[model samples]
Target: MRTSKHLIEQLASDLGYEYISDLHRPQLLPEIQILISSYDSQSYSLKEWKDAVQYITGSSCKLCECEEIKQYLLSLKNS
Candidate 1:
């Protein structure tokens, strides 16, 4: 079970951002390439995906595409 923090760190790393663990905030670029790339990866379970979306949406990072990711994840769930 991957925690939200772990997911955020992975996303940051995937996007070429240096994840700062001390801040516990994901340093993400304003690109959605990683999200699109991992859309069909299935590397995480549904619960992990939910947790990640929740964490990203609830965070103070306004630049994040959390809503879009949430919708994508929902589509995946439905399919």
Candidate 2:
């Protein structure tokens, strides 16, 4: 599956991450891309999705707090 840079950027923005120029955190883009591609390939579980979100945001807060992320996870779960 091809990872969309636009989706990664949107996810990062929705998750409240600020980017310097077009560079997201040192390794954030790749991580989010991997997470998205893995999901597209039906290789991720809800738990893994939550863990990745937590790792990316550096927060242990409820995943439901982020609607876009929550919706993405739900889609992954349903698939």
Candidate 3:
């Protein structure tokens, strides 16, 4: 479950100015791609995966996506 280009664009838009320089590290995008891939696959245990998901998804948090992702993760764990 890799992140799509549209999701990256959405995250960039949500993050606004900081995304231009501060958040846009050379490896950030690629790292995020891997992060979400791991997240969707539940590649880590709940504790580890939650931390990773929080770190990655919470970084660009101008929108409600973070909360949504958290909810989804909780559901996955419960299910």
Candidate 4:
């Protein structure tokens, strides 16, 4: 499963005014696209999210591998 556009949009919006936003130029939009495409036909997991990031941004953040990454991140303030 893929992360929703709302999630990605919210992530981008949340980070819009941050310096870390500069860490990932172009922001989460492209990453969102990557997340959706990286979704597995089976089940989505934190591992999946990380895979998606790895697939796109080439990261090793396995915590992001889950479909729940969006919700999980959203739950944290200033994520």
Which candidate has the highest lDDT of all?
A: 2
Q: Is candidate 1 or candidate 2 better by TM-score?
A: 1
| Residue 24 alpha-carbon offset, candidate 2, angstroms | 10
- Pairs of colliding residues, candidate 3: none
Per-residue error at 4 for model 3, in Å? 29
| Candidate 1 TM-score, C-alpha based | 0.43
Q: How well is each residue in 38-69 modelled by candidate 2, as lDDT tens digits?
A: 34432334444456555544445465433456
Q: What C-alpha lDDT values do all the predictions have? A: 0.46, 0.46, 0.41, 0.43
**Could you tally the backbone clashes for each prediction?**
0, 0, 0, 11
| Of 2 and 3, the candidate ranking higher by lDDT | 2
RMSD in order of candidates: 9.0, 10.8, 12.1, 9.2
Query: How much is the lDDT of residue 43 in candidate 3?
Result: 26
What TM-score would you give candidate 3 relative to the actual structure?
Answer: 0.28
Comparing 2 and 4 on lDDT, the stronger one: 2
Specify the highest-TM-score model's number: 1
Give stretches of model 4 more than 4 Å off. Answer: 1-43, 62-68, 71-79
Worst-scoring 10-residue span by lDDT in model 2: 70-79
Ranking by lDDT: 2, 1, 4, 3
Better of 3 and 4 by lDDT: 4
